[model samples]
Target: MLRIGRTPRQKPGGLKARTGIFGRLKKDRSGATALEFAILAMPFFVILFASVETFVAFTGEQVINAATDNIARQIRTGQITFNQGKSTDKTRTEFRAAVCQEIAVMISCSASEAETPSKLFIDVRTVSSYDNLPPTLPRTGGAGSDINTAGFDFAPGGPGTINMIRIYYRWTVITDLVRPYVTNLRPAGSSMPNDYLMVATSTFQTENY
Candidate 1:
């Protein structure tokens, strides 16, 4: 007669070893902090970079605004005249130089202010009324369109005339994570958005000087 004795119960050493190893792994907290920190680091750094970039963008906007007001004041008071036949006559290039002199600390400008291919775009003209001022941004079509500078001109009015100064600067975005939301400007036909268009406009009547 064969006695079925539970097959002599095989030793569970290997099973116990595996179970013990798994238990030890579960109890180990050596790498827990590191793992959690690794998981949180991505968002932490993203927020840091985004915050820094936003502050920088705000500073840039203020810089351009100040420059616009200063330049507009000069044009309004006859301190800066365009294409006038006089010893103090200033050209568009000179006007750009004047603007660059104020904003060069924040934005880049060529060594020669008269140089073309600048990131700064300026539109100064005489307007009959505020309603006649440009109602739209200097964009061609969509948000991804290239800046339309074809209609831009430098024709500041004389004394007692109404003049408008509109300045646009293509601010290079540093943080890639916050670029697209910062501005709607992007190069035409390019999938990647890059720049933050900074705009400043001043409309006022030139003082009778």
Candidate 2:
């Protein structure tokens, strides 16, 4: 029969039953968990990686501090002397070897890099008095700031002298996401910022040998 004024609508369970399908889709919760995880995963992973890198960086500092103390003790007790040109006198290269040996577990330096190490910079010098010690980290600034190694030398004075040993290392940071907050160094020629400078200094008076 043909409808006269208004056509009759189909029933809920009838052939044209789109209302039920739409309602069921609206009530579905299948993807809710995945959606929540996707929103939180990025921040969670970032925090996790930052924590790990911080711990590693701290451990590296401790290793450096211990090495500095050990090397300074040798200087204090006359076990290692410098600049006298004696048979047992230690040169700059020998001093670096001792330092690398102390920190080998955390940092490695091969035989070839002993003369000019890429990662480590060491300074051993005699100070006239306790008030005359050099700055722990000396920087030369103009265009780009860098560690000033110009006055750095291995001239620890002989017996009954005050000496200081300072060590600097350019630690390569791998996690770039937290690098800006972790360090202020912007290594020259690098496309991205990545270095965290670590410094350790020790001062003591040499024993009468």
> What is the C-alpha local distance difference test score of each model?
0.83, 0.83
Model 1 residue 185 distance off true place after TM-score fit, in angstroms: 1.1
Question: Which pairs of residues clash in candidate 2, taking residues 3 or more apart in a chain or in different chains?
Answer: none
Deviation in Å, model 1, residue 186 alpha carbon? 2.3
The segments of candidate 2 whose C-alpha lies over 4 angstroms from its true place after superposition are 1-19, 85-87, 142-144, 188-190
Per-prediction TM-score, please? 0.86, 0.84
**Candidate 1, lDDT over the whole model:** 0.83
Compose the digit string of candidate 1's lDDT tens values, residues 49-168: 878887888899899999999999988888888766656568788888888888978876877645574688899999888888888877788866768999888898877888999998
Per-residue lDDT of candidate 2, residues 1-209 (tens digit): 97679778757575446777788888999998999999999999889888987888889989999999999998898889886566658988988988899999998877765698677889899989999976445887643356788887888999999999999887878887878666656656656767777889999999888
TM-score of 2: 0.84
